[model samples]
Target: MNAERLVRRMIDVGALRFGDFLLSSGKRSRVYVDVKLASTFPDILEMIADGIAEKLSGVEFDRVACVELGGVAIAVATSLKLKKPLVIFRKEEKSYGVGGDRIGEIRKGERVVVVEDVITTGRSALSAARRVEKSGGVVGAIIAVVDREESGREFMSLLKLSDLIKAYDSFDTTKS
Candidate 1:
């Protein structure tokens, strides 16, 4: 599907909305994508997974990763569909034992495909990728449901890794 139409359907499913909203990373936005809604619906969930899968058909990568909390579900779903390992990155060190930034299976030098539900400021995915690198993994690319165009992609590229932001269906990120 075209990016515009796919994004519109996301909005129709209540996954996208417009407002002056406070984001998880404490930024304000005219729109928000409640990415959790994507995974909850099997139909849309498959669409999302297939969407990313289509994007990765030839790109060389091994594992899929999601930022903690919101992203883990979609990451797992994508991994299942693609039949690959799904890794996870934690927002903060677990207060319990270990206190590690990574919570799932990731090996050093392994190629990683990072996944997220949405990107507003985009700092969260960056943090997760850094942690993944520190753990010896190479973050090959990043993916997400909504790209609010709020500095996330630039930040992702700044990290020197491949990046793909499925921009929110409502707006045009291609425009200046």
Candidate 2:
């Protein structure tokens, strides 16, 4: 799908939110990409998966990894689309039966691409990449559905903050 169409859908679904918000990075922002909301809609989620998959088409990776709460849906969809294995990381390690921080196995030296819903400071994605490294997986890339463009981190994303902001501005102008 085209970027404009995806942005429109995101707006229609109330996924791209505006106004003051506190990000996971502990920073304040007026714009927030609520990809978790988008995931609730299968069509939107599919578009997201398509975008991520396209980004990884040329990149080589053995598995896709992401943390729970937000990135799970996108990662799952992308993993399915690419027919690749998925590795999920928990924000906190579990203490119960078969306890561990991750859900799937990562073979030694397997290349991994860390997936995230949004990239702000990139701490979340980077942390997942580090975990992949610790688990004996090589970090191939860090990909997100949207890049907030705040961190200046080297990563791949389907859409950037500027794209959303431009679309939002045009939307507001049309509404006026």
Q: What does candidate 1's lDDT look like per residue over 76-103, in tens digits?
A: 8789889998777776667788876666
Locate the minimum summed-lDDT window of 10 residues in model 2: 167-176
Per-candidate Cα lDDT values, in order, are 0.70, 0.90
* lDDT, candidate 2, 1-176, per-residue tens: 57788888898888888789999999999888898998889888889988888888899999999999789999999999999999999999999999999899999999999999999999999899889999999999999889999997667998998899889788765565
Whole-structure CA lDDT of model 2: 0.90
Give the best candidate by TM-score.
2
Clashing pairs in 1: 7-169
Return the lDDT, model 2, position 152: 77
Best by lDDT: 2
TM-score of 2: 0.96
